[model samples]
Target chain A: MPTGSVQHFLHGSISSNDTLQALLHLLRGLCEDAARGSIPFLDQEISYTIQLATGNSSMSLRARRSLMYEGYPWLLTYYGHTDSADSSRLVAVRTCVQAGTSDELPKFLSCIGFKKDFELVSKGHVFKKGDMRVIISKFYNPVKDPTHPDGYQPLANEYLVEMSAVSPKFCEVLAREMHTFAEQLKPLVYFEKFIPESL
Target chain B: MVVVMLISWESPEGMSPGHANEKLQKKIEILGGKILGKWDVDCEVYSSLNGIVGLSDTQTTQPANLGGATAPQQAIYVLHNSNYSLSTFAILEDNTVLIADSSFDQFMPHMKVFYKKGQRSDAKGNRYELNEFIIKTGVATFGGSQQKILLLEITYLLSDYVHESIGIIRELAKLLLDNSFPGIETPITVREDKKFSPSDLLLQYKALFSHVKKPSTVK
Candidate 1:
């Protein structure tokens, strides 16, 4: 599937693993419908970000390789500077390309004058309703081999719940719809846009 | 899928790149090759951020930089060929090549540190089709108009077998260049193997750039 440039997303986090399990069960029930049935998604991916830091300005590119995807495994996304992290529904110009299973992306980025900044493993479950995707994932720092099951250290004690949609252009209706979806998951986990710099 | 071979021609100093390109196109036409369309390959150079950002070795103790900094910081190259519309990112220092979507070029501006050194876009050329073979003649220019190099690319579109088409391509080059064949330089990746793919063309282009710009000495 072709990814859209305008990415609309809202993020929330649950502290306890018990709450996450309960939320997953609740999500399975919420997303259940007779026509499409209940769709539970398992997402296991490793994300690597490459940065080009000029003395004054710096830019970064991210590549996410899915362990679950056997055929088309890599998704390279470029987040433009126009993206606003402060908005209620965080909007960003995220251009994404689905690449083949070549582990040469990091090599390629390095070839293009970008240095590997960080690497993290994200394992999660996904719930879909229409175009909206609700992802609950945890991030881990790879201690040894990133691809190995036992080769990681948890970054935090919380599971991040992200509701997002990719659109061709900024659509108010899509952002509102995502906000509404976030509201439905409220009390279980409060979805808010947390700025990375502040954290 | 098509396989391509790139040959560099040293056009006479006085002849402008445009005139040289026209001369090659005429020769291809005389050989019963029909002009298919125009094709071009452009390259943009970007420098690394480490030296520019003033990050000392002690402060840059990131795991990603461990052992990666031994090689001197080399400028990055983002190359685009109009025919494939795919972006080929290469660093000639280590012979690393990555093929990505053309839209990847848009992300360059967002990277503050890797400043654009200069760009060469005048590597424009024409594409010709002769029988089952495809011929492309491009003038690689500097500063938009000063043609520096002439490149001849021959593609065998029928199959991926590189050896099978070499004889026919040689025969066509004999006609096209009037038996004065420019040296055919195969990229390191394809030098040993006989199989071919679209990415091979990008690698060939990278080889062309490497010949022109020594990656180690590049600023």
Candidate 2:
């Protein structure tokens, strides 16, 4: 895994289901090759967050487990602190690394002293244009059978809209391009690169 | 795959590491083992400022928002082996082993005040193939201390069960090291009804490394 790679992203939220549908429709029209299609993806992951027993600093251990994929290999992603991009960049920059892990990851983590924090499910559609990826997902509490639509509780009434591009070198141009693409979503949704004050 | 790790505690009455390696290589080659390639295993010691809370402690604690101070610093050995699928093994102080994807290194810097205290790498490790088995030998440079320890790791490719293959591994290790390998007998207690796991191999490594770190008794 290359340690120099970074993720440049912007976040926005759709207030309601109706607004989410409107925003999705708007994106379908705005995205390249609208008539082609979009890939629907379901993300069922359990995030094990371990905090230093003495401080507020913490790290999250998350692996993606999707029922749609055969055998459901756990593709682990280790996330570093999400740095708030400066005013000039207008995108949040975070360092993340992805690696292939086995199903014993949870048990292994427990042995090494990490406690399970929470598990959430996210289902949404993904749109891509060149190097850009736009994801619109809604969060839900874990369900017994993720393949089934019922027996799940929604964590939020809003849809999270994220636009991101991963690059090994510092990419100010890519961030600018993402900002311009986000601007096209206009009145339907407004994306910002702010990290909350509480974080 | 199952792995058994052993350390050559003494190199036949004052032989240097290089001389010992040459002797072992000749022995392995004479046994009809073919040199496969070179391997590298880097071990790093990292101590967490606010260490991860133990699971048992969390279960037994009172149900209050317990003050987070007074946690002991946790030290662990992180091993990266070139042969595995980028597997990163963490051997905690308590002999608890955790295996994670190699990319887990990216998250280490984010964990509260986690920093590397010492590091050692065996870049000249050798991988050899014998009939129905694989062998890896390396010399670990004890971090900052400049001490060298001989490492021998054996894998039984034909059998997945450790219990079924323990006798073969022990015999092979003894023959290759000329009976100077003391760690050979340590892994026997773990050979039971359970199948071999990579973590078990890592625990053996921790024991070997710590043994080399012990202070001398002569005053």
Number of the predicted model whose lDDT against the real structure is largest: 2
Residue-wise C-alpha lDDT for candidate 2, range B1-219, written one tens digit per residue? 764555544567888877888788888889899999997766666644445556445322121111245433455677776766478877666655656677666556555354334445343478899998888877766655677777777888876677678688888887887657663453633556777777676666555555555422101
Instruction: Report the interface RMSD that candidate 1 achieves against the true structure, in angstroms.
Output: 6.3
lDDT of 1 by residue, B1-219 (tens): 656777766655687756877888898898799988998887766555455333232222222111233433555566777876645444344555666666556555555445445445447778998888889998776553443777778887776766666667667766776634654534556643556866666766655664563311111
Where model 2 places Cα greater than 4 Å from the true spot, the runs are A1-4, A15-36, A44-64, A67-85, A97-119, A143-149, B2-7, B50-73, B94-96, B112-116, B119-124, B181-183, B186-191, B214-219
> Against the hidden reference, what TM-scores do the models get?
0.74, 0.77
| True-structure RMSD for candidate 1 | 6.7
TM-score leader: 2
The DockQ score of candidate 2 comes to: 0.37
Recovered fraction of real interface contacts per model? 0.21, 0.46
> Per-model TM-score of chain A alone?
0.75, 0.86
Q: Per-residue lDDT of A170-189 in model 2, one digit per residue for the tens?
A: 58889889988888888788
